[model samples]
Target: MMNLAVFASGNGSNFEAVMEAVKSGAVQGEVKLLVCDKEQAFAIERAKNHGIPTFVASPKKYSSKEAYETNVLKQLHENNVELIVLAGYMRLIGSTLLHAFEHRILNIHPSLLPAFPGLDAIGQAFDAKVKVSGVTVHYVDAGMDTGPIIAQESIYIEDGDTREDVQRKIQQVEHQLYPATIQKVIEQITRGV
Candidate 1:
């Protein structure tokens, strides 16, 4: 089975969804580690609840972001992580992390992209007056959310919908889409697809 290391920087709703998928055999993989940049992120609790190993490699602790990420990579390597999943991980992954894992890193973003690529994606979509916006699962690259697309789901935004409303819909899509894409990635790895 593919051994996954999940990265998160916040409340970990997406991380929890992935854990549920794994527990139900929907993901067809094993979660080997849960890594977070924040010391008190709720993701660590989620990992502990599911009996997954957890680690915190804060960037502020290291002299450089690259050094902090190197520490994370070292822990992942020690845990035998084969896939890295970014579920609400706020930090921008750099060249070293990308080189260490290559195309094995995957991220779920809150936009159809390359429509609205960065923070407050739902708000951006709302301000852009786009009728449709949703979720994207893509390969991680050096650029910010500019990696090759793997999958995307678009939700139609109704008239006068608030950013919160749009975000809620997008989050629903994210919960389903991330797990589905991760399953596909696992299949590709297992079958050499």
Candidate 2:
């Protein structure tokens, strides 16, 4: 089975979704490790609950970004991780991890991308009054959410929708689409497609 290491910095809702997908046999890999920069991040608890190994790489403890990422890299290497999934990992990936994983890193963003690239994307779409907002699963490049698109599923913004409403809708789509997209990517890699 392909080994995956998921990085998250916050609540880990997507992390939970991915774990559920693995449990239900919807995804064909093992989530060997959970990497978080925050010691108190709920993702850590989620990982523990699922019996997945957890690594906390606090940026404040490391002298530099490379140093922090090197620590993370050591964990990934030790786990034999074949794929890196960024599920709400707030920090930008440095060159060290980027070079190590290269095209193997994948990220799920809460926007159509190239439109609202950075954080608070759902809020950006809602504030901008966009009629359609969605999710994008893409390869993790050096830039923020500028990677090549792997899959995109759009959702319509209703006339009276609140920011929370839009966020909820987008998250629902993300939970389903991210795992399915990962499955497809893994299948293509295994098949040499």
Candidate 3:
């Protein structure tokens, strides 16, 4: 089975969802490592609970983004990670990681990009008063959430819906869609095997 390394910077709800998918055999891959930029992130706790190995580092410790990415690459190589999943990973991926992983990296966005492509996407969609907003799973590139789209699922924003309401709906879709899409990508990656 292909090994996966998930990158997360926060609560890691999507990370937990992917773990559930793997546990249930919905995805044919192993979660070999959890990479987190923050030492205090709740994602580390989730990884610990699941017995998944974790690599945590601070950008402040590194001289530059490349330095941080290079260190991360070492951890990925050590774990033999074949796929990189960005689940609420806040850092903007630099050219170092972009070149290293290329199309092998995938990110889940909170909105149906290229609409709200950056932070607080759920709020952006709600503030824009868009009737429809959703989730996007896409290949990660140098640009911020501008990678080629792989999959998208829409959710409607009702007139009375709060921003939190929209956030919850988007997250619900993400928890379901990210794993399903990841499974498809894994199948293609290991198609010949």
Worst 10 residues of 3 by lDDT: 184-193
lDDT of 3 by residue, 45-143 (tens): 999999999999999899999999999999999999999999999989988888888789999999899999899998788889999999999999888
The TM-score obtained by model 1 is 0.96
Candidates in order have lDDT scores of 0.92, 0.94, 0.94
Q: Scored by Cα lDDT, where does model 2 land?
A: 0.94
**Candidate 1 Cα deviation (angstroms), residue 76:** 0.4
Candidate 1 C-alpha lDDT tens digits along 44-74: 9989999999988778889988888888889
Report the poorest 10 consecutive residues by lDDT, candidate 1: 57-66
RMSD (Cα, Å) for all candidates, in order, is 1.0, 0.8, 1.2
In order of listing, the candidates' clash counts read 0, 0, 0
Candidate number with the higher TM-score (1 or 3): 3
